[model samples]
Target: MVDPMKQFWVTVAAVFVALLIFVALPVVFLTGAMVSAVTSPSASGPSGPVVIELDLRGGVTDQAPQNPFAMFSGSGLSVMGIVDVLDRAQDDDDVRALFVRLPEAGMSPAAADEIRQAISRFRRAGKPVIAHSQGMMQSGAVVSSYMVGAAADEFWLQGNAALQAAGLQTEEIFFARAFERYGVEPQFEQRYEFKNAVNPFLQSDYTAAHREATLGWMNSVYLSAVANAARDRDMDRTVLQQALEAGPAMGEAARERGLVDRLGQVEEAEQRALTRAGEGAETISFASYAARPDTRRHRGPVIAVIEAEGPIVTGTGGSASPFGDASTIYSDRTAEAIYDAIEDEDVKAIVFRVSSPGGSDVASEQILAAVRAAVAAGKPVVVSMGAYAASGGYWISSEASHIVAQPTTLTGSIGVFGGKFVLSEALARFGVDIRSLSVGGETANLFSPADEFSAADRAAFSGWMDQIYDGFIQRVSRGRELPIERVREIARGRVWTGTEALRLGLVDELGGFHEAVQRAKVLAEIDEDADVQLRRFPAQQGFWEQLGLAFGGGAEAARALITLGALANDPDVQAAVREVQTARARAEGSHVLADEPL
Candidate 1:
């Protein structure tokens, strides 16, 4: 028989040892890893002859994350940042060549165009740019892939990969018939016929105006893609179009058609690039090269770059989710950034970078006021559009001294729409009763989803919409220096490509972010060749603070609450959930720029 006291002591010792092994060891290991990561050298550039590797798989963003923690957690590369890297490499003697890995799912047409332009410049320096692709498919990806590939001095494709450039199309879902079957009524109104954002809920099919506008932009985009591709690939426009129509070509078929330069795997392509770069050549990632600190010290005037990305919402913008998806721009946060730039003595000008399809009208107006305030403070404001800047996007941009956009950019959806649906009938089917008591005047029940708009309510809503529409036209007229009549002619919720917008006087120039920066320099009276430090707005949080915020339980809990609230109130989600209710609004509806599909 064993002694009870001895056995108890031995058991206690064993448990203590297990705890040290299971808990303490992991804690120590994690601490050591964190320390090493923090202390690691920040130099990302290679020392000798390097072939810069550009990966186009993830698609580009307009701005890099400002927070260091977010960046460390693998943030997507910004288009401007990649362009800057290429510019630097063009002058870098150590960089012998450029290698590109094409994406399977294509990037945005505007983004691909910018990258193509950068590559063209790089090639002008007598350096080879080689692109290798696995495959390109799906809607919109084919054109994007071809555009980028055409910029390369040598384009290669995997033997099994297919070139599926089938052209462009737009799709919209209509819910009117379904709503009627469920006894839900959709009531909506818009300033004009061209503002068909609400038509999906009000009509079973495209109205004549809707079809006309959609076809207009779709054709414009397709033609532009073909022209650019033909010019880059040195192929006849007609021949290229026919090949695209008869696509899904593979291997030698693609090579024979001059669509690709060679058929091979990625390794074979890399070997070719290395051969052109000469002996002792190695590859370095574009991301790593971009992360290196600038060797030149910039003491010149500062040009602040404030990015207003995503839908414009009312409060302070939410932080990026843990998954790294971007969040919407909040009016308060954007206004704060504008004010910060204006108040800074070092910042001589502001470049407002906008990439949005538009959102809350009130939120847009608030941001516009901030822009006016910045100008009032004697700061020259310039707007640089990426992919989109329409409706509320244009609303905030109209007052800028100058606006720049890519030819492929979509802009100018100047319109307003509003209305709600009557969901009482739909609910009655489920035996749900909803009742409301109102003590205010006639318009108090105007927004109630259970009731349809009365004549008085309709008149009031129409008059309100007219007032907003009139203000929109006046702003555009004054800003663009065009007559009110001309502004009205193009303002009825019509969408336009950036090229068309420039011709119509809706935009000041056709170009990208670099052009905007150059314009800002001229406005600030700085020389074209002079060095100007580009500063980002809404300054990033400190390293320690970000570290805590990223890992702390507090932030996670708060994010959960905010997400729940967003799910309840998000306009997109609300529109989807209560389709009938959204259709019945008298004249109050979310006005979105129609370029999202493109």
Candidate 2:
């Protein structure tokens, strides 16, 4: 029989202790873990001979988050990181060789070219580089993985792996017929015939001009691939082209056909690499090697590498979701980064890396304005085109002091198109109605989905498109220093491969990031052989700030944070989210180029 008051106080204390153990303790543990990861020290240099192991299965991006916690967050490797590692290895005496594990799916052609160029440079430093592939499939243009492997001194494929070098192809889906069945109509117009971005919503099949433009770029990319593979394997171009047409070769057939150097498993490839690296050599993860601190110090002018990737949009670029899922180029964010570089006295020049199919006209203009401002500041601006840089992508790129692109880079779609879909009939089919009232302007209802464009609307819209298209051509003519007539000849919304673009005076050179960097160095009046530090933008946030953004405060933020966190951890969910975002973007009138294969 205990006293009542004492018993009540004891029970309250027990409940409080239980809450701390069950709830607060776990949160504290996680927060501490995050802190520890962020504050961890960088790895030191290797003491013995090392063969750097690069696993490309995770794919590569132009810029990866610099947050140390990014490793725990499952972010993939970056192209610049890999290039930096290779560059470091070239000068590191303890770095004996390089061993790469190629992925089943192919990378983007431009990305592969950049990595391949780095590998070529590594080999030129007298270090042997070997590539191992379990299987290579015809995913996303198919020639990418092989192109990267061709740069290696030795290439090995597993006995069960098949070589699917099926070449490049693209498909377009039309929804005009579907829209008709659903009682919806798409009203759109473009500046010219070659601007086929709107064709998916206007026609059921490819128009003549659309077919010509598509085939022109496709043929250029295909021939480049065939020629590259042939040159790498020391085989006849015609024979290699014929073999690719008859591909899907497996095991010994791949080696016999000169597609691979040897037939073996990954272990065998590792043994070969180890043998070449000599006794006492160990295989080290490339990530860990890259993280090692550089004891050597150099005081040199900084060359900033600012990346503009994904669909361009207004405002600061970030996933709206609470979890830091993916990134895109935002006009304000990019312009701010450019302004930062321009203001930095240490930054001598800038290399703007663009990987986009293009988006909003206003957003593109905003970024173009930043480029112009950078030039006016007396800092040299060089554009490095990656993957699909066309239309709005070219819009922002035109004013650069120089432009560099991979031979297979799809670019040069200088065009504009816009319109609204009338969905009133579709809603009526579902017994729903939309009513609108407007005041003050004749074309005030231009974006209203309930009404189709009137004759006046069409005329006014056409005039607007003509103005944008003319402005686009003038910019290109002025930037590229081509005659207005010559620019017009290639301007009509036509797409060109980097090779063709170089010939048409659209791009300054056909090369990868290394070449672009060399050009930047020369433009800055720095010696090509001089060592310069590369500063990236936008600047990385601190640990606590990143955590705050990742795990939001308040009840609503918590719910979204939890949901997004779950989605980010699930690959299937992430993929679904991407598909949904792409569909939504298209529905929202994002103008992506037709040549983007992904």
Candidate 3:
């Protein structure tokens, strides 16, 4: 409607405006990326020289660290941080020795072993490691001290404190009676004579099978402690146990009992340690150590450390607790991550760092498939098992080119179980009358929102479980190079230590995470002199996490704050909880996680 010249001018103006907006968008994206890039790498480890202190608080769960890595959604001690510290300590000749101030709680046996391994490797350079604590040490901290204690020139404890190896005990929080009281019927199917995954939800007391299995593990843990303490003390295992039962050393009783080398505080302990190391106590706190590039000869090939932490679920919705609490739906997210690692070309070898207690069978299989893909890609996949890697954990590790586990790592539960709980009676009691109908079977969709599973459905579940059991046996046998019969004979959901697992042919080697990485290096024909840059495939943060950081990252930083970086949830307990929840919800209603059909 206007003049042609004016119209042309308007069009040109609009074009210029659009160009400017597009440029501005890219600049915003770039800015956010830069901030994220700067923040994430800096948050990994502290920024100083090495002085190590572990803030050991809370109940020890399967999860290693409980702090979230940025918005990476998981909890537990900073395992990567631990690894980094050990690596630094080992390489730094200036750093003479390590000191254990005091851990707050009793660490899990597995964590104790991890810490012990790190200390031992540090001491390989023929340096002293000292433990000086006023608080009474729990089994975890005490046992860890023992590993390096004998080698240390001196071991010191507070005058009033001593070792309290309470031995191992298992307590199942049974809500079975609770379920029955609430009018919910616990139902399940387990094929093996000893598959007891559903025991806590069904029985009021330990089944003979469950009792035997539990006792076996407890005995193993106890005996190991006895041997460790006795060997270091130059005494017999029986004598040590008798001493422990009598009572942990009180005052001079600890030194007299040989439970401790001396009764002293930090200053005296440091003096003794100095004598042992042929130098003054080189005091260092772990907090001061900064993240530096790994200067170790890289061996020319890069081994990608894909942290397979948290629950092996269907999708990643973690950060609650990576290892023990409910994190991801069983097996889903793990499979995706593994597949992604496999696709990265720069990754010459794969280090599947497992810290899971296992999860869904289907999910486990999916992860295995990704590992197989990596193998097919000419990348030899090696596994580094963390604390509890049993059941589905073993399922994935069984086929690795090599597997490394700590001597105290709990593993080797080659088992399968399925169950459900029906709440029909509870609903009826609540006066919520419900009815439903289905066409195909005697109790199709019985556990629908409007119905309860019929007797027929329960029977069908049991029958289906039998098939799954057979398939599980076959898979394990093939993976472990055992005959089907032998696999069945040992396929009860039973836990085992790394040492026991090695003997049972369940693990390739009794070693720490670095050992696995080294093996991968050898298998990949990496030259010993080549540079090895450690790469970690930590969890990628989510959209909201990015947005929040963008809005107030500087403000949060301005508070002059420091974050607790290392922490993870127990993956084992978390997966178990997820499994229970999935089964119970399925029994409650059919449509929530609809797998079959509406």
Candidate that scores best on lDDT: 2
Error of 3 at 291 (Å): 3.9
User: Which candidate's TM-score is highest?
Assistant: 2
Ranking by lDDT: 2, 1, 3
Locate the minimum summed-lDDT window of 10 residues in model 3.
Answer: 560-569
Residue 514 displacement in candidate 1 (angstroms): 1.0
Q: Please give the CA lDDT of all the candidate structures.
A: 0.77, 0.79, 0.61
| Residue 453 displacement in candidate 2 (angstroms) | 0.7
Candidate 1 per-residue C-alpha lDDT over 1-598 given as tens digits, one digit per residue, 9 for 90 to 100: 8566765555455344333433332232233322212223433645779898998776677666544335434436778788778988898888889999988765676787678878988999999999999977856645877888888999899999988777875589999999999988988879788888899999999999889887877677677777888888888999988877786888788888778899999999998998899899988778667756566426788999898777888986344444355647789989889999998999999999998888888899899998988888888899999878888889999988899988777788898889889898899899996675678788888888888899988998889888888888888887888999999999898888888898998898988887898999999898999988888887755443343243332343334433433443344643443443334332467553331111
Question: What are the TM-scores, per candidate, against the unseen true structure?
Answer: 0.83, 0.83, 0.74
What is the full ranking by TM-score, best candidate first? 2, 1, 3
RMSD of each: 15.1, 12.5, 14.6
lDDT value, residue 310 of candidate 2: 76
| Clashes (N, CA, C under 3 Å) per candidate | 11, 0, 57
